[model samples]
Target: MSNTLRISLIAVASAAVLAACGGSDDRNDGYTPPPAQPPVLNVTKVDGRYHHNKSQQDSGFRAMSDMPPSASPAAEIALPALDAQAQTKAQGDSLGGPILIALPQTVAQAQTAEQLASLLHWRQDAQGQQVAALRVQAADALGIRLGLLVQALPDAALLRFYPDSKTAQGYETTGAEINAVLRLNAQAGEQGQAARTWWSPDLGGDAITLEIVLPASAAAEALQLALPSISRRFVDTDSDAALQAPPAQRAGLSKERIPSAGSCNLDMSCYSNGSAERDAVARMSFVRDGKGYFCTGTLLNDAIQSDIPYFITAHHCISSQTVAGSLQTDWFFRTASCGSPYLDARRTTRTRGARLLYTSNVGQGFDATLLALNDAAPPGTYLAGWDARLNNSIQKVLSLHHPNGALGKISGGETQNYANCDGRHCRAATDGRGRYYEVRWGDGTTEGGSSGSALFTQSGHVIGTLHGGTASCSAPDEPDFYGRLDLAFESGLKNFLAAAQRPF
Candidate 1:
């Protein structure tokens, strides 16, 4: 837990720096320190931001929310249409589209060693003259050769290319870049055939869009190699017509009208015990304030635990001064669970469940909180909303909550994306998912009655807390309101999980 992290450094002068980046599994790979040179040139270490050096470490950035900027795209290339590729490449497993790799067209026969040696800056001559030699320093760096290509430029001559960088192919620059490198190599090959060397520094342009001709042979094999690296997620680009709304609709919620944050609908739901029979509700007694019973404990599963007991209930329902009739020790969680019978006459007559972790934002705060189970919950019972991989991206979820005077009663609403708050307040958009658009309250909207209610996504992702609403739910013009649980509870959440794994 106390391990250190190193910094990262990038050399603007070389594309080779990228080799080390994607080159190895080692987190420490990718960067090479410059030889100690001048006092002025010495690399001084800075905090948090990527230093691109192995020495500085990852601890800072690993936990940070922001990332550094990347390099700019290469220059665009222009060319005359060439012949159709020898044949369309045989399609292999696709990485959506980004992982495709192949060679560019080849205009002529192979280049002679004499021509290659003359054109490339293979080595420097002792007499101060430049001598031609193979410029490649490493074989792995050459990458898998895809097929070839040849294209006629509006201004320049034709050329060939090679592709790499698919997870299957295992080259660099995953997708678009894969296409780029191959085309460049193919062009270099074409020049080699002509007995010329030293590719046009710009290769006509810094980049090329190879939607056209390509070489044959190795292209398909190389494309197969890049399968895994290709991203499968697909988001269609908007149609051009959608770009221009009818003049009248232009003023409506047009794409231009939508902010990156967009909009949402909200609904709110409140639950409370209604039965007048005091003892009847006590059977499921979780907490009893003068008004009524808030909740009764439910058993939970032992999975994902670090030797601790577990169970979940509303934060306030556990023990809220506003809700608990009395500040009695018996009111708080004593064991994993208990019934209104008060565990029989014998002080120890009650069955002891696992330790239960509990979560809650201040009553004035929200429906968000955490519970550390003293021990795992009883069999068959598990936390309803949880996904470690999905720390905060829950798309659609709903929660089950118990309100005062209600034992098994439940209240919940669809969760919305977390809002950015300047201070204690957080805002979000919503659609009529649940009760998010319900609930009348000035205590910022979600009334104390609705406090500690669980708000989840439709997909069961644990999004945020339903603390309160403004305009309709929390405030008008202001989106729905909820406890920024993820952010608010972020500080020690992971630490708690880690500690559970390694105990004293």
Candidate 2:
């Protein structure tokens, strides 16, 4: 059959499949179908470093003196302790695989920018620029993330967040960028409670200082920065305790010293033969509804083999650009070496934020979300190959994911059958029209943070993304369902994955 005719048939079949699956057919219901072909993307390669908006090397504060004086301390607030037993129970009960890590706390004085400005300590930096800083301390907390409601911010203003000790490692952004993200969130129909709030990246430590630097010509009175609430992470997924040890001492510590996946979970480093495939996977942590969560995602190579940082994950994890804009990924988040439990302390590269390209939920027949990162992928990271053809005969499969927000783990399995899954239950698609690939694991199992991880064929080409199922260490014989990537490609992924022209 001619290529044109083949595509036409597939399109008709896809429409029928959606209708059979009870998906919305009404165009007015806010469901937009993918275009026939992928649009050409204009991409420029970067220096392979994580530069979100501005350079990370740029320190807004020149020295400790640049910060506000201790006498005029910003409003101090302490978050309530999260219940350890409750957190464990919540993890066991999570069916869709998003591990909760933080609790939202309301700040009484953050009702408006005017109210917040009164709490900040205003000073003049060495550069003679107007600077105002607020220090929020959550004693004994693992991480702190702020939610800012940008009402009126000056274009010349710059915002930076970092630990009190680490001045250079701060994450910086501009008021203009925050406003732009808020506008994008509004356009995407994200008008929830956290709609106008732009979440800051997880600044590791108990206390974080938010500093705003205004141009010499700009007036601080014109600035508007409101903090309605903040999220305090009680878990230590990005713990740096291991780094405090001497290099030789860290190398000799036993696996028992580090927190990791279950004993049955296989380390991805053990199977380093597929280094490219391993590099393609990343541990993803994102914020939604003022809470922090974890999942997995993969970097995908398009048909033209362009390195555009196109990413794939389950739609259930992230279906909106607003959440996508809060994405932060840990590259090379595996062990230090094969069979070792020590995390690679040297691999500290983390890319922050993304732009949601396309997404389809389980109700739409398959679960998948495509994203374009705000910054370039880390150096040496590989873009994974994919197989978009629907073929149930393909048997052997593999998966690499971060279980319970720990180091990467590998699972080997085979496709058993097609099924329609709602995370809790699954029914066999007797007519062979199911949207998910049901697989029973033989080597390892998945956990709460493993959702959206890729299910790859033996050839290292991804065929599906994990949605959820009962498969675990306790029930190795039970099946796990992955939303078929072929179905996702047919629905809308083709617009980004099936491009013909090479990236410039």
Candidate 3:
């Protein structure tokens, strides 16, 4: 879900008028611009990929059904405590800037087997069916591997857990110690028994101790709780599929800035006036190929106001069923101060799961996706309002998103033109519902984490979600495209977003 959305650079394509009725155009006649010249580059495409690898069985550990209780008390060790107050002192304190410490302690295979045998008990499953279960007490010296729990980003407000082993798919439990337990019970993909990942709100501190519990129908030998690797400054402890693909060519962009685009600027924070509506915007973090990625999305309000936690993002961001199921969304993920240095202002309110609702083909007119968040939006959450009328005379538009997973920011642009196609694909001239808004920014620009963010008209109404374009600080003249809200509302979203019933 990172900045993997295919960004379409302005291309050399024939420009054809898309509408004859002059629908939705609020621009004055003098605003008509000259024909677009051949762009230096064309569209950029990156397939949405997911990474799920099978863990190999370890030989040293063996599972046992019954064992005598240990006569001696279990020895315990503790990891270094983090000074959370110092870490979040202000907008400037970043948890020492993304440190990754590989723990030196590892439990011997024989000792691990003994620990399991002593603590595990036969308990009923969620359905009350009997099953073998174990709740390992938290101790620095007691994890399956070195530091089973890694200190999350000191600035991170949440922790997301991904059970790496497929065998644990049926009965693995996470966050039990933290009371945010998530059971990976849903089967995914063609096999149906595929394992899934889950998330938790920030534990109100920088580091979190995870309680990994394994459940099995029958006592078996050699069962292991395979935990994934952890990355700092964010909760992407699992692997990412994007890392396996060919490295993205950034032309001449700096490596550090390339991954998360554009720095904080004044023009980036103006549109919302710090309204609650901005709370609907969130930064998305993803793990595909042992790497972390970033993208943006919005929590939307249905006409019925069911408050069912419906989210919208670019189809390319969560295109496949696997990717959709594995998504982790961070709410209220912005800085405490406007244009403040990038600090850990991310909230703990997050979900590691989502159910894919609908999507448009990448090559088709609307590259959008609708998803139902597995959990409802937490308190202080706002559902964004939207307008679905096509070509309704939009003069200027504002964008709210997290660029490169940075603090929430805004960009502004005037409606420059309407087009039927980009470089390779074009919708029919009569297909008014399929047209996209060609916008040239007057203030800030978008990057990787900005995908799927909402594009709103002057009246603060959402008109579209980000598709992709070439607009950046380096190439300010380059324009961007957004999938029209009218098209998506008419296609697959009306049922959920246009519901007439209210939750009041």
Candidate 4:
């Protein structure tokens, strides 16, 4: 049969199934149906007209030339060597698990304001701003992330991290931005130690220099900065060459890339279809418990089709607002061409951080988390549509994800049945009762970093997000489960996705 005929049959079959299962009124367990009409999923790219207003960065920034040389070299703190055996074990076990990269280490000294001041290399810029610098060294590390416990950070204070002090290239942030994220986390009931700390992004290198710039009026003692801990990355998941190295050469191989997904996985570029779906997906890298991890998330289009940068991912990947605040997304993280090994360097973009809007626990039912990105998505990105109708039925499904944190890959599958699944264990559920869609892959398979990927229906509308399952390259016939988007829509997602709420 033709593809069009096959889809028509599937839809008719679905309508019949819904009617048999109790019709529209009783299809949803106990929740009210959405107010808007069913989504239009035929469009390839939702236009950028609805894109949210991009926030402007702080202006009047001074370059490195404005600052004078430090009176003395900053005191250095050296970190311990990475455990090769532990890293190998983590990599092997990560296939069906979280993408673990960094290891936590405590700062032995200079945690307090007084001690930090003593160790800092103090200087004054041409503008007379007080500048202090500190160096952190971790031999052979792929990257470094610092955790700061701030008591009070003045509005005028600016923080910058760089590999070299002479050059201008570095990550810069204001105290207000950091404190704002922390406040959001606290409001979301994230009171854990991780929530209390503001994590700095990982600047690739073995060592990094931290520079704090304060107005001349503010004294060194005025700043209440504490460095309780830092995370040192053992793997380079974000690098373009991460998948080039062999398994045997991976251990302690600084130049050699970390292994990618199994060879059986299919690259997204290999397919001509699903261009919009590919643009909507992103590779998510985050820090939790002082360890770096990766997952996948998709940009979602709301009822109004606004480009609010609303995102959806697995609750398991980011259950709390604190972890959401730590999210860094890589867009257009695919190959340069069809079946090409090299990445499209010009098209790739990275955005930092997001605010957690809503989330449902795994134990509760559907494992999903919604977020509003802190920055606007890059140009040419798409906000994917979703189907939340209770009567919606998925026949053929597709998943676009970055497995093993490498380049984006696509997997094709068919929806088998409704199931109640937690990780690998799955059991059949009564009609209209299951929280997940049990899927069997025919082409590619999901791996470690594929968690939180969107499950797209034949018409290109998302119906679910990837939850844990037993599917892999070794067991292609095994099933994978995706938490139902219909269930998620009923439980708080409607507030943002539907037209019921104020414009997001």
RMSD of each: 28.2, 8.5, 17.1, 8.2
Off by more than 4 A, model 3: 1-210, 213-274, 289-291, 339-346, 392-394, 420-434, 500-504
The per-candidate count of clashes, in order, stands at 94, 0, 21, 0
Q: Weakest 10 consecutive residues, lDDT, candidate 3?
A: 20-29
lDDT for model 3, please.
0.44
lDDT, candidates in the order shown: 0.23, 0.67, 0.44, 0.69
| C-alpha lDDT of candidate 1 relative to the true structure | 0.23
Candidate 4 ranges beyond 4 A from true positions: 1-72, 88-96, 164-169, 236-259, 346-351, 391-394, 430-432, 501-504
Model 3 residue 200 distance off true place after TM-score fit, in angstroms: 8.6
Order the numbered candidates by lDDT, best leading: 4, 2, 3, 1
Lowest-scoring 10 consecutive residues by lDDT in candidate 2? 3-12
Put down candidate 2 lDDT per residue, 1-504, tens digits, no spaces: 101000010000111111001111111122333334446433211112222222242222233434344332455555555577866675444434476677666777777887898887777777778877787876667778888887778877888776665332457778777777777677666676566788887756777877788888888788877888888777655443232223553433222222356667777777743456877788888887677778889888776555678888877677777788778888777766764545665344453577777777775457778888766776667788788777678487888888877777888878877888653456668798798887767777887778889988777788898877766777666677788888877776776777556322
Mind giving the per-residue lDDT tens digits that candidate 1 earns over 239-357?
22122233442223123111011012211112121111111111122212111222233222222333332223334343222112111111111111122311112111011111222
Best by lDDT: 4
**Rank ordering of all candidates by TM-score, starting from the highest:** 4, 2, 3, 1
Cα lDDT tens digits for candidate 4, 230-311: 8888875454444322334223223324347777788788775466688888988888777778888999887666667889
